[model samples]
Target: MPQHLLLIEDDARLASMVAEYLEQSGFSVNHCGDGLSGLAHLTQPPAGAAPELVVLDLMLPDIDGLEVCRRIRALPAPLSTVPVLMLTAKGDAMDRIIGLEIGADDYLPKPFEPRELLARIRAILRRKVDNPAPNGKTLRFGTLEIDRDARTVTVAGAACDLTSYQFDLLVALAERAGRVLTRDQIMEAVRGRELDAFDRSIDVHMGRIRAAIEADPKDPKRILTVRGVGYVFARQQD
Candidate 1:
């Protein structure tokens, strides 16, 4: 079975090219030219099946891609967790950061190679399938609990809503608590790739994770910043 992908891009020429290429690359591609229609396809699946991944364009006819991403994240479970890879013509760091902060799993600047896009898609999907933790193992730090087999995190017995990527990042950090891991190392461990120097996507993800699991995101303790170094998972979480 080929993985299904929904592409929400307004440029017909580019959409057609990408769809054809991805189809040849062993994916089933569904193309939507506008944000609303794409949202509909995802929220109200045709044939009772939603695409496994969404390749979203930042510029859409009906709505901006950021709004579309927000709306998707607001959808009910399973649907809300669907991985999003944002595509943008803008090379601005702010745009990429904003997209990731809004729950996009990854971002690719436009005029990108199809192979790179395919690789990114595979990387995100692979993270979803691969669980590195030993079965039944759970890591506990004070009130926070990370269950490997269940693929869940709970703070004070209440579940935290983290995306698969964020969950993986947390697990990676927790596995090596009390040690600072550079952004490059952390990215390699969780994303299976080196961090791009200009890409602050990791920081954006960290912010989201803090918001979900921290008592106060403003003063995070569980995942501490090493300041000019990287991040450390506190050995002592109170």
Candidate 2:
């Protein structure tokens, strides 16, 4: 079955163009012109047609994309875990960073090619299907537990809030515990693409992960930085 997608965009012309393009690419596209309707659609999807992903716009008529993402994450399980790909016209890196910090799976700046949008959507969905961790395999480092099959992370038996992409990043680093992997290597491992030179999204995700699992995000103990050598998951941890 073709994957279903929900697009929350206020720009009618752009929404039509994106929805049409995605439908042509074999996805079932449901477009909402405002944030409220988008949330309502997600909350009450048609039978057997729950969206596998969301294409969200930063600028909306009702509420901005960031708030919408936060509300989505706050939903009950399964719904909350659905992947989101953010679209933004803002050239400011901060907007994208904030989006990632709040649980967006990925983001594309405005004026992007529809093909790139399609590619990004496919990549995010692929991560959902092609999980890097083997089924039923759980990685444990002290108090931190990563259950691959369940796609969940817990610290000391308490659930850690992590987006789908953030969970994958933590898994990648944990799987290669104690090895220093550069930013490019990390992105390649998780996203199947090298990190762009100017992209700090990976770092932002790392911060979110740390905030979830670490005793203190500012002074992280589980995921450590190696000065100029990228990051390493400390094999030895509390």
Candidate 3:
């Protein structure tokens, strides 16, 4: 069965092109002209027809995309955890960073190739299927626990809220704990394409991941920054 995708884009021409292109690429797309309608569709889909991913436009007719993303993350689980790939026309790096900080799995600047979009969508969905921990093993550091099979993270028995990409990033780092990894190595491990341009996005994701799993995001111990080198996941944690 084709994976379902919801495209919340106000541009009719672009939406038509994207939906048609994605359909041709073996994805079933449901396009909405505005953010509110998109949110409504996500909140109440027809039976089990919920979308597996959302292609969200930064600028929307109503509520804007950032607010819409915030609302989606505020929704109940499964719904909140849906992968989001943001489309931005601003061509601004800050917009992309802000989007990642607020739970978007990935972002593509406007005037992008349809193939890249397809690849990004595939990458996001692929991460969901690829388990880093072999045999569904759980990686525990101090009181923090990551269940590879469940795709969940908990600290001190409390659930940690992380986007799909952020969860994968954490796993990539934790699996190689005590080993300093450069940004390229981390992105490579996550299988996220086009890293040279979007390397800062990794820092944005790591910040969010630390905010989720680290007791003190300001002074993170588990995930440490090597200052100009990259980052390292401390093997020994309190």
Predicted model with the maximum TM-score = 3
- Cα-based TM-score, every candidate: 0.94, 0.96, 0.97
The reply for model 1, stretches above 4 Å from the true place, is: 135-137
| lDDT tens readout by residue for model 1, 60-168 | 8789999999999888777888889999876777888888898998888988999999999999898887777655489999999998767789999998878778888
| Minimal lDDT window, size 10, model 3 | 193-202
Candidate 3 structure quality by residue, lDDT tens digits, 15-103 = 99999999999999999999999999999886766899999999997788888899999898878999999998756887888899899
Instruction: Predict model 1's lDDT versus the native.
Output: 0.89
Instruction: Give the candidate order by descending TM-score.
Output: 3, 2, 1
Count of residue pairs whose backbone atoms collide, per candidate:
0, 0, 0
Residue 134 displacement in candidate 2 (angstroms): 3.9
Question: Looking at model 2, which ten-residue stretch has the lowest summed lDDT?
Answer: 127-136
Report lDDT (CA) for all predictions: 0.89, 0.91, 0.91
Q: Give per-residue lDDT, candidate 1, residue 238.
A: 82
Candidate 2 stretches greater than 4 Å from native: none
Query: Measured by TM-score, how close is model 1 to the native structure?
Result: 0.94
Model 1, position 63: C-alpha lDDT score: 97
Q: What is the lDDT of residue 23 in candidate 3?
A: 97
